[model samples]
Target chain A: MPVSIIRPIDIWFAEQIFPHEQRFHAAALRISGSRDEAEELVQEAFARLFELEGWAAIEDPRAYVVRMLRHIAIERLRRRRIVDFRQFADTDHLTLADDAPDQHRIAAGRERLRRASDLIAKLPERCRTVFVRRRIQGESSQEIARDLGISQSTYEKRLARAVELLSRSWQGDEDALPAAAGPANTSRRSGSR
Target chain B: MSIFNEKQRRKRRIAREAATWLARHDSGTIDEERFHAWRGATPEHAIAFARALAVWREAQSKADADTYHLLQSRFTRRRAAAAIGGMGMAGLLTAGAFTSRAYAWDSSHSGVGECKRLILPDGSRAMLNTDSEMQWRFSDDERSLWIVRGEVGLELVRGIPARIHGLDRMASLSHGRFNVRLEGAAMDVTVLSGKASAAPVSAPVVMPGQPALIPIVIASPSEGLLLSAVAPSVRKASPQHLAATIAWQQGEIVFDNEPLQTAVREYNRYLAGKIVIADPDLTGIPVGGRFTSTDPADFLSALELGLGVRATPSNGGYVLTR
Candidate 1:
């Protein structure tokens, strides 16, 4: 059975760091001048943020993230042995002012709730059923498996697929979405044709 | 490039593993020690788990019965279409669906003293302030919204950028939250998050094989643009002003040293019975504070106590005089 021990840092990262992702990406794009580099910069900054001993003490995680992104960008440029002064100069305005956390969270939550159904609607049939039953319907896995006449492992696989697709799409990976299809559909086997 | 691809593949795999663990955990079948070890193995794993958790939480939220039924119908419709395949009936059905959806515009309105929250067809959230009228039309390629009157608070999801129409002015918002209000001959777009560009409605459309040139005024968080066909200007809003601008979302009208007339005008938008300045001399008096938008009793009392302005009962509203 799963032990439900929630970590403080996990909650902090989810609530504080993850919500302001657009700002971080915009900042990274401005500094890096390429989408790939910006992705790397943001990722590296996040990894480094996870490692920070004083992450819990950060008053403004949003601004701290920008600072981390800036530092990562500068470090990469320095290591390259050739820095673009103009690019370096443009990183000055990266630090963002903190908005009221409650307002931000409320707004973000509303957006997520609004989008969740649409995302769920787009899921392939089998996965959608398993996901909706398990998540939205709040049915136990054993109950869902029994009702659907599927094994627990099959239920897990379908749920995982749904989650993976949603995770990618929710994170703004739109252009490269794998064409969704039912498990038994031969068209899906031929790849996104 | 190969290294990047390898890293991307690794990330995807990690995310998949995270999803599996989440599913297992939710099922009450996850092995505690193994799941903990997997999550703590690397920072990436933890981040992936958090990302999945966020989505999981949202999807697992208790939805109204109407929403569940709507989702079920949508799912069934899609499945029916898929099952029909490349038949004449399918073609006709698809065409009928397109015709009905393509030209149909969904509209929402909030009457005086009432605020309404709406979830648009495309999964964007729009909260209409009192006396507001908004209409939206969505398609595969475009998500268009028209703010006919008053104010709207929008939290748009990432997808096709939404084009907001106002009085001879428009703004294209690429997924973000904003408070858009229609004022006299202009639209005030306040960016709470995300990026939006304001331009005139008459801006040239991009034609194939030709370069397009349109002046774009982009607004960021805590920034606003006064979008008018004649002149579009961007301004930064102080935190206090920003707070005041959006306080209407909470059914409160906040005035930060705003002129008495202006404050009354703003408050009148939410009241069935309006507040009027009977004494012209009281128009320019600076007013400050937060008051319930739907009621004017507290506001009137504050004015009487602080500014010594007396409010007398008028026809259906209150008339303030010095």
Candidate 2:
């Protein structure tokens, strides 16, 4: 198809899909955050679907938009994971993947995604709950906290703390809070200054 | 590049490259070879790999936690209700009462469809609704007040509090009261009073033994006979009515057997917007409910049961009618 004739097709698809885009944009922000990155994710997702050469071939356009948007959110989060991984910067290597890392590293290139879930199962009550709600159900912190009878900041702190603990566990460091053999039986919370 | 600057520069270049790639891929373009090449490039490339992986894991966990907790909440509620059965749930008024002495809490007028309150530092209270304004100032010797426009209710705490202690202390006003509707029509006054004086209104200064309605038309400024006649016999509020009046102090608005128009006007006091009754038949129907007043649904529910009116979402708010 010539580029000149194909441009109107973009407009048609955009109009047919505007409501879902708006809803997805709103739902994405509510799930993720009110940051520029989230806005970028929504815009890029819609733009990509609209701009794709195969844009005319979408089956169930709503689901297609959702799938693209969700992928963008997941990928964007992975690229920005550094400062969030601070507390768990030193866990043992051998224990890392075997220690149920799929439950831990959910979706990434080289890390053991297997241990991620197991690591979550080992988290303290608050952090684990916050993690499940935000990442799984795609609920906003406000919604989670409202249901849990707590503040949104408290939920954020829980997630941050949970991430920090997971990083330490993956690196096999022994000081993150653990009830059972935390960090290779290292004294839990002993590193707190 | 030198080893010191070499790794630093490489890391920065790769991070920029990686961020750009992620941004691009987020637009749904899968650049497979370039993404793979970016992953294999350097030790700092490994660092980027680790960072992205960790973030992805945590994001997934948060998603997990949200669902886990929501399911828990849903189950907990269902279980409790199944065990105990549904009853009218009144959240306890556990908040402690405070003698909050603000210099003046938010002095403002009621607009065409607005209602507000004025809080005096000495613990007295006033309600302002529907195109009204009021102001107050406390002095070493007296409590001075002005109702600039609109209607207000004054429940004198000084006298009630003074009587409790039985002290000979006095809270008198230098200038008793200033009745001001001078800019517009005329001033109106009713002394639900300890002692109140009205300006531009008549002489023999009205007292609390009787109700007084005085229209101050001090025409020509010099010839002013404030015609103050007895405001007809009236009975004090029964216990139920007193309870109704004071109910709002506890963040509730109580209306029992009040006409729908009257009830809607009361609900409109604590709410940001108006709840209008368009139908005259609906207005006369009695409404009875104990509502937190901040909730729009409470009003709707009350109207639904008490008056057989339906609430429909209109624009940004609700409209009620039969």
Candidate 3:
């Protein structure tokens, strides 16, 4: 087929594949649902097939993309960075976690997250990314692993390590929550005890 | 530093080390046992690793701003530097060196960075640099070029017929971005908009945008249809032009007030000539004008005149004596 005809088909296939990209992250999240890892798996899937020459040349580009992403994510789990935004149920909402209906407060919190993000940005290239996908974005271990070409097991351990040191590294810049400190209530109890 | 500051510094130091070790381990330098031993050294070690991971994640969030910004910046820097040093055009001009094609046509074209030029069935000449792949599409009305991978220079003459689809009409087509349909080999790039559209092997008209593979015919064009065809193989952007593709044709690289250091990248493209800007402050100096690609002297002169900097030829390439 001439290239002209292939493009529209690609656009169409891209939409279909997007869901699969989402599902894969959810699957990876089952093991370690860190936002970073989930997105890593999602991104790796997309990158693996982003430049695929012909959508029809392969029988199932989606499956191929998924499998390739899974394999790559598994490989990257040992490393850091697989590749996209891992979508949780409410990712598009852009609201804060608070029960209050105050948009201004939510916006303020987002600003704080941004500041916290700036701190995380100081990390080295790959690991900093793993930190983002695993911590900031709440991606699962498998997804971050998939994105970074590492294993899921390593993703969990590494992410736990990231969560352990947020207070000192970030110092007083508070907005984003530290890696995985349970809940505010749990923290208060621990602090009091 | 205060006591809190000192304590915080010690903690961060421990965390940063642990993070570096984990990153290294991920790189497969250290084994799991070693990783665990380090982990057990102190609770601070674990915290440090976690902190480092936080830093690492922040870098990624920034990347979400643009997936290829870091990579593109490097390419841009190199391209700019090459243009500034005037070596890309210079080497190509003096050597008239054709960045060649590895068409599996000849043995010599198959090297790491070989240059090969191919005479299209149309009179246009295509020069492929090392590690580049291009396919010539010879159809009746539209003579198309599929630069499947890497970069190639296309020179168009008057008679070559490369039918162009305008950027406005692009909503209907999906061939490529930056399609330049020129007349023959050196007709000058005029159209670089829209995408490449043509049939694939068969029945894949709906699948474009993604890199495409089709069971295309291998034979050179049949003789009879040659005369009736008028194709403009390359399509360049018309309104606001991009310089990358056509820079190969002009022996003079034109930078419109680009950073002096950035322009040196254009020079590095053709020759092993490297330009080091010793003064980091001078790195941001704006540069403009057309310099002959063959010599760094002209480029150095531009820097001296434009930015009052002295250029020193290094052991390998050229360096701006900071």
Question: Could you tell me every candidate's TM-score relative to the true structure?
Answer: 0.46, 0.28, 0.29
What lDDT does candidate 3 reach at residue A135?
A: 41
Decide which is better by lDDT, 2 or 3.
2
Per-candidate iRMS values, in order, are 10.1, 21.4, 19.1
Write candidate 2's Cα lDDT for B169-250 as tens digits: 1112211121121111222222222333232212234477854455322211111111112221112222233334444434
User: Model 2 over residues A1-193: C-alpha lDDT tens digits?
Assistant: 0111112233334223542334555545543565444445655665565347876445445556656655666566577755333212221121222222211111221122334566678889887787666655656667887999986555555655665565444333334435475467574455332
Candidate 1 DockQ category? incorrect
Residue-wise C-alpha lDDT for candidate 3, range B1-322, written one tens digit per residue = 3754575456556655665564554444446676677766764454344334434433433343334233332233233333344333322342222123224222112122345677766566666553446565553454555443334555544443453221111111222222232211111222232233332112244465654454322111110000001121222121102433344444434443445665775555444566777878886654544454445566676566545678777787777864
User: A10 in model 2: Cα distance from truth in Å?
Assistant: 73
TM-score of chain A of each: 0.79, 0.36, 0.33
Which residue ranges in model 3 land beyond 4 Å of their true spot?
A1-193, B1-117, B129-150, B155-245
How close to the true structure is residue B85 of candidate 3, measured as C-alpha lDDT?
A: 43
Best by lDDT: 1
By summed lDDT, which 10 consecutive residues of candidate 2 chain B come out lowest? B162-171
Using lDDT as the yardstick, the better of models 1 and 3 is: 1
